[model samples]
Target: MASTVIAVLEVTLSWLFANAKGRDAKSFFTRPALANFPEQSITVTSPDCGASGSKLQVDYTQDGTGRFPALQWSAPIEVAAQVKEWLLVSEDPDAPLPTPIIHGIYTAIPASKTSVNTDDFTVVDQAKALMRGGFHYGRSRNGLPYIPPRPLMNHGPHRYFFIVVAINEELDSELLKAETTREQVAEAIEGKVLGWGMWVGVAERKWE
Candidate 1:
């Protein structure tokens, strides 16, 4: 009974303090490590979520399959030719926290690749993915490679930024493992980032 009461209070407090007008991924880039990276002409799109600034489908969030959505992207000819690898980060700056809540960290993507399907990132199929690629995954806040959006109930809309970074140098393989943290990924890419692009998808929890 005591634990139950505590859980209820925790939920209530979170709901009460939630910001209805939450910030988006652009705010996330203001951090010192990322502030210098130029915004390049990379086109990132998702068929599952329509387009940037569009509402994310339930199928990609905690409400449904919770799979990482399929994504496609292209870098400029010069950038592509120089890029040694690509890094993808998904996070929610609107989350009621001091820092954005990281949803996923997928790195070491081959420079030759331009797209990824759900099969390439669904955590359940990670073993299969390892057999087919040179890419690696970094642990999210929940200790998994991906955590689908799960905004607090009544917290209004939360934007999930799928930020794709083009890196001129290959990230240290040691820092691209399952135990790696977001800070580590940021550190690994600090001066190596050539540029980046982003796609934003919004989700909100209206029901408990």
Candidate 2:
């Protein structure tokens, strides 16, 4: 009977300890930078080669789903600096808006990983759901998932920048409320913007 009680206490203690660390890991987005954080390199990739600044068709489809373009990046991105979290941001600079239109805001990408595989919506969605406790996907302007660009008639080709940045600290869910903008995410990771990699993809709409 005494051994049983001890076993229960041990398990309870271990669970408590893990939750405490989890809290710290999830607190990065809310913590302010006390000093400048060092920079570390991270590579962002996509199966869709936009290196020529090519245009991404809005009606594009992949695996029976809206083509969200697969994005891959370097993994275990430890410059051995103060870093843990990563943020995936996609925005269009020329969307006829006051500021660039934000398309996606995904945070808490594990540092011990690589390749987001956005091409597989199921994969990304599963990750988003599992990470609900610590990570979040900020909604776009239209309150949708990572969105592809759709320019108006003759709006010309729009430059969409897909940026992958590493953060020195873990982010908190509270810091990333629904419909959070990239600017806001930037602000949160500003001082601690350890490193980043970006790929620019172009999209245009032609009106006859």
Candidate 3:
């Protein structure tokens, strides 16, 4: 009886807290690590997403219900050549847990003779598109997209980083034509990096 009463009290307290804040009590309890993020020299922006911008949406899960925002960046002139086989990597350094989360990885942007203006998400031409098979970007388990059964909550707000790397040589057009992993793309660009840039955004969904 005593334990039952304690449980009831706990539930009531949680309920009150949830109502007081406009979020779930559990969400309120979680500590989002927005402060301890790594410093980056480059600046990133998304013309199609963010509260102040165009606000394009990104679905976080396979159910396609919850969505995050789509992001883009402005490429500087020095990094333009490397953009041809560019690799965009997003990572959270300060996960509440040990291992950092890799939120997104996109590759194979067109090499820009000039700087890429903001709002350029897709490759400019058919030839520059990441080959259909291996180049598509998303969360994949063993190279296949599999949505998790249970959501990983309480992880705090994850920092989504987008990095652009310039490659030295033209990748194997035949291998790229067949589709390749971002790792392979990185391998192709290993020696010839000209310049790189990165930007970050924060996101998290906690249960109340």
Candidate 4:
């Protein structure tokens, strides 16, 4: 299972490890520190995103800061008690950390609820919408309805992965209601995952 930050250390940690001035073949970078998954790149598409949606080409930008209200999914939910529409945003793992930061953990959306635009970001309206739609909000690491990505300075660019997963079995909603990490969610949905889609956004603070 995956777990999810780091402080301002250096932008070249991984790079420095790769090309140490004096090291033998058995030294650090030559040896594996952890296991990894096979890479599968996700694509993104928007009106301004043009015709292609490859990895760096699909950038997640802010028209201005404090832009925290929108969602555009490509699929609809199936009507079933066991079927749930789940959303999550996770930080990259390479940064020094004990667990990956969880940006969002929303679940149980109404089958008819497809997206949330800027106009729908109000707390009261969102609550009303969720209540009307029978949705549930889950643990967010930052304790906000939503926290825009703010990767630390010198931590290098972080890949914020926003994913929509179809969970086709009943889950422990109680556990997800409190503090939860990305790995916990991953473990919960392991064999129960019906389908999944993903989008990636890069964020970083310029080092002074």
Which scores better on lDDT, 2 or 4? 2
Report the lDDT of model 2 for residue 138: 76
TM-score each candidate: 0.84, 0.66, 0.51, 0.55
In order, what lDDT does every prediction score?
0.76, 0.57, 0.41, 0.44
lDDT per residue for candidate 4 within 1-208, as digits (tens), equals: 1211232234455344333222122211111211121222222232332232222221232313534334555443342334455443433433345445555555555444555443333344443323222444455666664556665455555655555555556557654353554456566666665444455555555545
Rank candidates, TM-score, best first.
Answer: 1, 2, 4, 3
lDDT (Cα, 0-100) at 57 in candidate 4:
29
Give the poorly placed runs of model 3, Cα more than 4 Å off: 1-42, 51-68, 81-83, 94-99, 113-151, 174-182
**Candidate 2 Cα errors over 4 Å, as ranges:** 1-41, 50-52, 57-65, 75-82, 119-135
Per-residue lDDT of model 2, residues 66-113, tens digit only:
566667776342452555876777776665544666676777767655
Compared with the true structure, what per-residue lDDT tens digits does model 3 show for residues 21-89? Answer: 222212201112111223332345654344321312335332354333344445555555344555455
Worst 10 residues of 2 by lDDT: 19-28
Winning candidate number (TM-score): 1
Q: Name every residue pair that clashes in candidate 4.
A: 2-183, 3-100, 4-99, 4-100
Best-to-worst lDDT order: 1, 2, 4, 3
Error of 2 at 12 (Å): 66
